[model samples]
Target: MEWLARVMGARRAIEVGTFTGYSALCLARGLGPQGRLLCLDINEDWTHVARTYWRKAGVADRIALRLGPAATTLATLPQEPGFDLGFIDADKENGRLYYEEVLARLRPGGVLILDNVLWGGKVVERRQHPGDTSLQAICELNDFAAADERVQPAFLPLGDGLLLLRKR
Candidate 1:
């Protein structure tokens, strides 16, 4: 993630699910000295630990933490394409919605990455477990993104799965 940000010369980025702020740290370090990262998460406990680590890493000044529902927070931002990079690792049920919101805000030629896309390989299972909303959402997103013309999609099997979309 850090390499991607730096290679793309990202100055403004946003992360939708900042669990412990590790990803945020990587992004903050990748960004230029004057760059900024917006972190949105609903859990204060996790974010507190993230904050401590960010401070320790000396990147706290470059990141802004917003505590609330990620979707709601995203909706409040202006409709312009303001982000050079985006990472989404939040609630599974709202995965597609988050993707849409983030992709809409991604600048031309920007990158948007969605984590846990394979959902432990359940996305391609022959028979899915009943009520497995996460699996369903991931499969739907994979198909939607691949068919969408606004971005070029690449699925990497790193970790569970990393879906990368470069906006056209």
Candidate 2:
């Protein structure tokens, strides 16, 4: 992620899911001194840990954590191009909404990563279960990205699957 940010010359970024801030820390390390990151998560308890680690790593000044529904927070953002990169690792059912919101906010050539897209490999199963709504949502997101021409997309098998997009 650091290499990707450096290569893209990304300065502003948003992370939708900040469980413990490990990913944020990784991305922060690749940013320049003036770079800033906005992290959004609904849980204060989880982000409390993230804050601690960010402070320990001396990157707290560069990251801001917003506690609220991700979709609501994202909707409140100005609908203009600004962010250089976006990471979506939030609720599986809302993945597509997050994708659409982030893609519209991203500048040209921005990278968007949607994590846990495979749902433990249930996306490929022929039989569906009762609690497979999340799986269905992920599959829908995958299909949506694969068919969308506005961005270049790749579905990787890495780390529970990653739907990587480079906005065109």
Where in model 2 is the C-alpha error above 4 Å? none
User: Candidate 2 overall Cα lDDT vs. reference?
Assistant: 0.88
Residue pair clashes in candidate 2? none
Give Cα distance to truth, residue 13, candidate 2, Å.
Answer: 0.5
Model 1 C-alpha lDDT versus the unseen true structure: 0.92
Report RMSD (Å) for each prediction in the order shown. Answer: 1.0, 1.2
Candidate 1's TM-score: 0.97
Which consecutive 10 residues in model 1 have the weakest lDDT in total?
A: 126-135
lDDT of 2 by residue, 1-168 (tens): 777778888999999999999999878866767789999999989999999999999889889889999999999999998899899998888988999999999998888988887788777782665578888788888889899898999778888988879999
State the lDDT of candidate 1 residue by residue for 1-168, as single tens digits: 989999999999999999999999999999968889999999999999999999999999999999999999999999999999999999888988899899999999999999998888787781556588777777788889989999999989999999899999
**C-alpha TM-score for every candidate:** 0.97, 0.95
